[model samples]
Target: MQSYDVRRLSEIAYDADNGVTAELSVVVPLYNYADVVIEALNSVVEQDLTAVSAIVVDDASTDRGGEQAARFLAQHSERFATARVVRHHRNQGLSMARNSGIAWSSEPYLFMLDADNRLRSPALSRLLAALQCSGAAFGYSQLRWFGEEDGIGVADVWDPARLSTGNYIDAMALIRRDALLAAGGYATLADDHGWEDYDLWCRFAELGFDGVFLPELLCEYRVHGASMLRSRTNDHFDALMAEMRLRHPALLCSSVVGVNP
Candidate 1:
């Protein structure tokens, strides 16, 4: 990572009127991951693409994550001239934090990033090209799960058509802001099955919003102890999948009440 001198918090907070239009808006909803938030922010900041805005929504983190992010913003004012930090008065779920970021962004394209994940420099350019050329509502690149490695080791590819049957695109995918808003954003359903991104993808299909998948790994998804999916037990995962199938009958080819081959 390139080192830059940190600026003052007040200086970073100053709002400037940049006449240039934003090509994309990156929204990261942060919880208590103070240790990793700066890395996530830097990934977006160092992107080669111009006219991109990074919006970090602090979901009322009780830990020092929020304070650390504010401090980083203070020193990196120029890097995030268009960037803004919004906070909730109380704790809201991840979906709510994402929705808040969407509401605040004015860019045409929106890229959702998990606070612990990092994106490669060309990832944004590649996804944007696919979205533009295919005329799809969104696009996703192959993901490389990161842990003890510095670069990509394995890749996950998805068929766009299969995604209609089951969610194949992760939350880090790039999506059109207008299409997302038209689908009514993320749904807050039963607490036991709060699969916000999956629900949103299903709605996108229903609304005839198209998407394409790029086969190259462009983002690094960190897997650690604090990972959300890791924290969920087997029963929790099963319950959530069951609820999802029940809620969206069209997505499942097999009987909702029975197991599939």
Candidate 2:
């Protein structure tokens, strides 16, 4: 998939020797979620790791969400090793928005946070530690669901064998930049209402990269009617699954379209 040019609004200098060593780039892709984009940015600013950098990609949001995010990040620029607000000239899909952020980041690791979600703890340090020690493609933790849904979203160890069934991990994870780029980043499927993360994980498994799971609730996911999962109808769901099967035939069997997968 092709990526487009983005306008850079705010940028903070990176000073590694002075304790501003940027290792992880928190990529927050914002669409029209103006109301909560700041919350997501705030979570990034609050990360305990001084090595944290941030890239907020505003995908041509009409709701002025991009401006809001730029303002917020500009206010807290000093808190990050490197902070940037990249705005897409037009509205690209979620995958491309993330790709834009990835293109702009200079860090070794990445963490994707939706605009409506927030980090519950100083989880980046722990996730970075796990990834460093395990040499995994990515590291994920349990998520706490809120808003329309309230509960703990559990995660499991990455198992390629289980991919044929369905995606068990969320997009909210700490990932290696090299592994992500090697996988060609997130797929921009025409039928993708969601499941981009699933496609990426399948590619990772195909590349012999595994994910490390940390059993801590480090992030909160807000579920609402406008959320991708809530908007996906049965037909939409089927079409996306069909696309997944076609793209990753080795990872997804016929069972992927069945009720079990």
Candidate 3:
């Protein structure tokens, strides 16, 4: 895939009045997760919010996931009002995939949902309400974990106050599109600390952008064998963290030490 400056793309594409006036733009990036792509797309479509638009970026999936996602969009195009599907010719990392989605979105607020995750009925609505009411640049709800078991377990609530102490916002959370662009999107991380969402949250905090956490469990984050967390590329994650600390000393503290309280 060709490399383009995400910031430049965002500046050129950030037009709030041109497209739908939806309260949220849900961007889902899919790779080879063909088995779950339809379900993920359906989850967003099923949301009760009428003004929401979803943009699914197919990151050059070698499998049928991209085709399946295109079919879903074709069948339920009206439900989302303005649903778009983008494809990359070659496989790019998650960071690039997400950046593409952001560039394609015109909504003021954005939600980053993984292809394996599904949102609860009112998840988008609740998160948007919190952002509106609190005037926070970003907002997220409690995430529930699901798998083979009917209900494996529920994740803990994300406390916005504790955000500075650690990474609280996951990629499945909601954020202001402009704020995300201002923070320079996701950074390329090393093996150990390459979790894209973690790096983004730290950057958000450093920029003085605030996020609100609704206590409601508004989304289900599925963890399967193919999940990125399970892959655990430690070297890449660590290298990313090291670079992040060097780039933003105030946000990450020192490369050797954990986030400062």
lDDT of each structure?
Answer: 0.70, 0.80, 0.70
lDDT of 1 by residue, 1-261 (tens): 001211111112223335656779888888898989999888887887876777777777878786677677667756653777777766777877777777767788999997898898888888998999989998887777777434443223443345434455667889998888788777666652336777777677777888787888788778777664445555665676666777666765444332210
lDDT per residue as tens, model 3, 1-261? 122554233222111232546868889888888998888888888888977887877877889787788777778766775777777767767887788888876788889888988988888888888888988888877767777433323223444345435454567778887788788877666543326777777677677887787777788877666665455454454565566666667645653433310
- Minimum summed lDDT over a 10-residue window in model 1 is located at 1-10
TM per candidate: 0.83, 0.91, 0.82
Candidate 2: lDDT of 223?
A: 87
Q: Give the Å shift of residue 7 in candidate 3.
A: 11
Model 1 lDDT on a 0 to 1 scale = 0.70
User: Runs in model 2 with CA error above 4 Å?
Assistant: 1-19, 257-261
60-153 in candidate 2: lDDT tens per residue?
7899887787777667777877777777777778888888788887789999999999986678999999999999889999888888888887
* Alpha-carbon RMSD, candidate 2: 3.4
Candidate 1 Cα misplacement greater than 4 A, ranges = 1-19, 148-166, 192-194, 253-261
How well does candidate 3 score on lDDT at residue 160? 35
Candidates arranged by TM-score, highest first: 2, 1, 3
